[model samples]
Target: MHPAPSVIFFTVFSGIGFGLLVFLGLDTFYVTGWTAFVFFAIAYLCAVGGLIASTFHLGHPERAMKAFTQWRSSWLSREGVCAVVALVLMGIYGAGVVFLQVHWAILGHLGALFSLLTVFTTSMIYTQLTTIPRWNSWLTPLMFMSFSLAGGALLSGNVGSATVLILVAALIQIVLWLRGDGALARSGTTLATATGLGHIGDVRAFEPPHTGTNYLLKEFAYVVGRKHSTKLRIISIVLFAVIPVALLVFAPFSHLLAALAVVSHVAGAFATRWLFFAEAEHVVGLYYGKR
Candidate 1:
């Protein structure tokens, strides 16, 4: 699948933002007054910024709101609705907390639940795509959930939870990558099956679809070389998991290290998200005989 920059930013940034909002709502870490203000500011910036970024992925950005009406079937639409609901609940709870220093415990909890659900719906958008074998896994949602919790913990200075969740996220990432690398082969999708030519011995693309790249080639048939992808997987692990965990282990003694850990984790997670999109092999590629 095409890893559009806007969609990548939306998923990575909003996942972290919503993750932070989730922890804030659950009162997972101590925050109040100016501290609460800063946390909420960061959360809203990431979440809302991500939502706005997604609009750029649309051909008609002005009509993006029409997506909200498809909540009954489309996971993308469900994600939009969930994001709005999460933001609204958090906004109401945040107004009091940031202004009057009121926790509004119930509202906070509800917002937190919705925020997590938003992430779930976002993951479903990808997982529901049977066409993309790499994304069609329970591990995708778990990975997203873990990244959210881990990133949220890092942002809120919850070292212990961050440490554990980072480990979980890293493990899931490793396993998913290993599993995803083989998914295309195991998917039972071939040019023959895809073109309804199984009765024959083989099927292949004898001629180019066009003299130049077209929309299908540019979008659904994007490919990353195996070696380059492997290198990126290592870089992503180091950035998203290893380095952050190491820095966080020392964060209790140094404020700067704590902040650096969060930065490293965020950067790492962004790389991870990029790889996620780049590595996906949309079954549509079978039609191009690239599978």
Candidate 2:
């Protein structure tokens, strides 16, 4: 799968936004007009911004609305629907907190549920893809969920929550990478199986499919070589997990460092998200000899 910048920005930015909304709904901190303003701004910027960015991936951005009708079977559609529902609920909830300074307990819980569901649906968009074995695991969704919660905890300045969630998310990410390293090798999908040529004899492409690149090669045959993957993975872990968690632990000594932790984590999230797309093995690539 291609790792378009728009999609990466959408996932990391909106993820943090929705995560913040989840914590806000829990009444995890004091709700003041100032706090409400800051939190809502962050949430909407990421959530709505990410949603808008997603359209760029479409050939016809104007027709993206058609996706809304396929919620029954499409994770992408479900993600859009859940996002809209959560945003609307959060909007109303924001109004009460920012204006009246009163908490609508029920609305808050509903908003949080939908917000988390939105993240889950986003993860499912990748997890449902059978061709990408690494992403096909349950750990994919868990990774997304953990990142959201951890980011939310950091943004809220809740050291206790951020510490625990970041550690868990970090650990999960490490395991994801460790396991994902072998996903391609264990896939069992070979040129023979793909073309159902196993019974006849060993199947191998004697020559290139075509002399020139086509849509399949450009879109599905993306290959982030093994050596590059190793370097990116190391960078991702340091920025996404190690640095932020460590900074948060020491943040009590210096609020400045706490702020830096969040900034670094967000930056690291971008790198990791990029790997999420780059590392995926699209089965169509097998036809292109990418596998």
Which 10 successive residues of model 1 have the least lDDT summed? 247-256
After aligning candidate 2 to the native by TM-score, how far in Å is the CA of 212 from where it should be? 0.8
Model 2, runs deviating above 4 Å: 253-255
Best by TM-score: 1
Show model 1 residue runs off by greater than 4 Å. Answer: none
Tens-place lDDT per residue, model 1, 157-255, is: 778888999999999999999999898888887787788987977777878767888998888877765449878888889988888888877545487
* lDDT of candidates 1 onward, in order: 0.87, 0.86
Residue pairs in candidate 2 whose N, alpha carbon or C atoms collide under 3 angstroms: none
RMSD for each of the candidates: 1.3, 1.4
In Å, residue 240's CA in model 2 sits off its true spot by: 1.3
